[model samples]
Target: MEPRGVVLVAAGGMDGRGAMSVLYIYPGKMRGNGLDLVARQHLQALSEAGVKVECLARGAVSMPGITCRFLRHTPANALSFLPAAYYYGAQSRFFGAWACRLLDPGRHRLVVAFEGAAGRVFRRARASGVATALICPMGHVGASGSRAELAWPAIGEERLEEEYAAADRILVRSRRAAETFIQRGVREERMVVVPGGVDEEAFHPAQVRTPGPFRLLFCGRLSERKGIRQVVAAWKEAALSPEQAELWLAGSEPNEMKAWLDAACGAGVVRLGFVNDVASVMRQCDAQILLSEAEGMPKSLVEGACSGLATITTSEAGFPVQDGVTGWTVRREDSGGTARVIRQMADDVEAVRRMGASARQEALRHYTWAAFRKAFREGLLPLRQSAD
Candidate 1:
């Protein structure tokens, strides 16, 4: 993991006499499968690469060699009554302003930051002549679809544009994400497609599904934009009974969709609700499905694939499924196709098992955390020399 060019130093050791030191700002907790996980992975990559790192985040994550500064906690439910977008935008702006004050060009060679909260940091870093890399985990803000399609809100495309204009490099999660940015006038050379990764050990291939009903798993927030309603529609079309099959959903159930999902629960839809160890749940299931309308490369898809579950996803969801080999890539609007795939898995268990095996092999080869670390180190650390 030591990618050459950066050095880890002690506290207050910034005599402006180091190899390359970085100030990483995420502005969110370092725990979920969303951007939080992305931030944690980047920090891990930077640390393993022997890069000097200082992290600013909403929640504290203790890593042996990195300096982590936890910001004052502001729970999202604090503003539960308002629209989700406002709370996220306000949080990003607040964190960005706070993080901007901590930037000392003499100490930090490069500032690695996430979008929505990097505008001020980028501006400050540029003014101070420090290098800047913006991590756009969710990709282009202007991409068409519901705002909730990605993990976070767009955070105002204009604000993101300001950040983009100042960033020396923009790191995205997938080729599709990079394409969206290119379509929106972002120079291809300035953007790096650093796709997401899976923890191979934690999400390893399942040896066998738990005995009983053939289960279909959906892991994410229960929302309309996530195509939950469509999932239910497809399940209805398949018309499997509890004895024959079951649909397992693992995520927070929002109030808006609670009533609808509650009704579905009676008809073989089991809500495991907010699971922490997703691997355990995936191990018990026969297959996974996510028909998202838009995404930057969902970790769930990679995790599922790594867990040896054939996926039913959309091209827009950004995981390159090998069509009948690894999984089925369905249209966002094609519930019938999804239903057919579901029926296929139930009717042909051996075929589903073969698909899952292929998926795990593909994931292990391309989407492991080690691979992500390599890509991150290679794509961004060279800026260290320029900064030096």
Candidate 2:
């Protein structure tokens, strides 16, 4: 079946530089993040498939190939409430519906919600007979409640439930997340598991640094849920003397984690806050560590694996890494167990190299963008036909 057209509404900003025809709708101004990269990749894939694509953001600065549209009202927080509020608001809902209505009838066949907040618009589109899908990075609900939710009680579970029920299809990053949606009232068949993909060309072993000290790297927001504190504590417990290995953290630290870093009293841990050149850091590191309490399929794991780094991640990461083969999978809350694993890997240079090699091989075999594009097309095909 030929696709009419697809509209992607994401809380995250759009970065579709090249596409035959693509339209990306952001909840607020676009910022550089995982979503932006994914948007760019999506456009590239769709363009290669001979689809036309255009991109726009509510409050985004214009990029090279994507068009930017501004929404008068600002969203609360792109990560949390703002998108939810937009999804529920009458004005945003009406605006989206009207926009979709104006799109040449039969020209566009599907509307995809990139994040939860985009649900209302997509729901309205579906109500208007357009096929709808929600592309969630971490799933419909946050597995572990976010810091924003904890700090502000206003972001309730009820709103999330509403978003879950509204979508025609829920695109998730892992089987675990698909299960989460099933529990949240979405039918099993309505959910699709399209694991996140890595740009092998950009994040490959060739870019990594070689012949260096066993550098341990941790990338992601240094927040409690990300388990940055646990990782730091584990490193301390492992007690690798200065010459053995060093911990390199490349991400923005949350305020709560700052005190932990100040109290740690160690020079071995290097905190490089929010570095854009992540590939460089990945290359320098011998292993990548992610102790997140909850995740969808983390991009870091894919990138780390692609870059030939032995990854130490939590079960929440949801990547199909074989235990003792591709990388080490540790329990989310068990710092002691995690530390033991890291120490063991660090102690054996040959074992670390072997794991890194396997990790790279696994990434190349399964996590490439080409694989993801094929899966995405297959997953959406049935729904597209049903919409017809």
Candidate number of the best lDDT: 1
Which pairs of residues collide in model 1?
none
* Model 2 TM-score, all chains together: 0.79
- For model 2, what is the error of residue 227's alpha carbon versus the real structure, in angstroms, after optimal superposition? 0.6
* CA-lDDT, candidates in order: 0.79, 0.66
Which window of 10 residues has the lowest lDDT sum in candidate 1? 1-10
| Ten contiguous residues with the weakest lDDT in model 2 | 1-10
Model 1 residue 252 lDDT score: 91
Candidate 1: C-alpha RMSD after superposition = 5.5
lDDT of 2 at 104: 35
Clashes of 1: 0
